[model samples]
Target: MTELVGIVLVSHSPELAAGLRSLLGQIGSAAVPVAVAGGTDDSRIGTSYARIAAAVKDADRGAGVLVLPDLGSSVLTARAVLEDHPREGVVIADAPFVEGAVAAAVTAAAGADLTAVLTAATEARHVSKL
Candidate 1:
């Protein structure tokens, strides 16, 4: 089975999540599933957490979930959601948002393991001035 990767974007703003989506599209990896949380109107903490949790849980193949967050609340909500569903293949990385998104998209497109994709995203976060 060719495991499909699931991307969970949890940012302080919806724009960040949207931007990640666009990047993923540009990278041309349509097979990867993406779930987004947080944005301009998503101020309710618990709600965002719930959305993220649902997204992760609903990813079809359940190969793995990679979470990328922007700021404070985004991080907190992602953490809470991940805690609530600590599946073995899930990985929540503290990486730079946009950069990590692109790296993840590219890695996922290449059919890399979820762990490798998350690690690459984490490494991409520190590559340069962003």
Candidate 2:
């Protein structure tokens, strides 16, 4: 069985994470395993590493995980999550939230190789005019 690629969106607001999931869904990735981790209007740190880890394992056929974050906390939190729950046949790419989320989701949906995914994420991160 092919491994389903997983997407973990970490942001200051849960809305952004949900938005990414919704966007990816619109892109026809509803079947793919995607997860959102962050604070909601009333809930903070809505999702835990255990959840993410389970999602990764559930999706880990071999595809990998692409982690997108809103800010530095997201970055640190993501690292912590991955560190706590390590998954084989799974890779977490460090990419900026906005562009990287879209690019990573698209790449993962298409079963793009890890190199391509990471490259796209890297390029997306540094492409801002500012």
Winning candidate number (TM-score): 1
Q: Which regions in candidate 1 have their CA more than 4 angstroms from the true location? A: 40-47
lDDT of 2 at 49: 54
RMSD of each: 2.6, 3.2
Q: Kindly list the per-residue Cα lDDT of model 1 for residues 18-83, writing each as its tens digit.
A: 677877887787678877776544454323766677767765366787887777877887788778
* TM of each candidate vs. truth: 0.84, 0.75
Q: In candidate 1, how many Å is residue 19 off? A: 2.5
| Candidate-wise lDDT, in order | 0.76, 0.66
**CA error at residue 15 for candidate 2, angstroms:** 1.2
Q: Superposing every Cα of model 2 onto the true structure, what RMSD results?
A: 3.2
For model 2, the stretches where C-alpha displacement exceeds 4 angstroms are 40-42, 45-51, 58-61, 126-130
Best by lDDT: 1
Give the distance in Å from residue 69's predicted Cα in candidate 1 to where it truly belongs.
Answer: 1.2
Native-to-model Cα distance after best TM-score fit, residue 111 in candidate 2, in Å: 1.9
Clashing pairs in 1: 13-39, 14-39
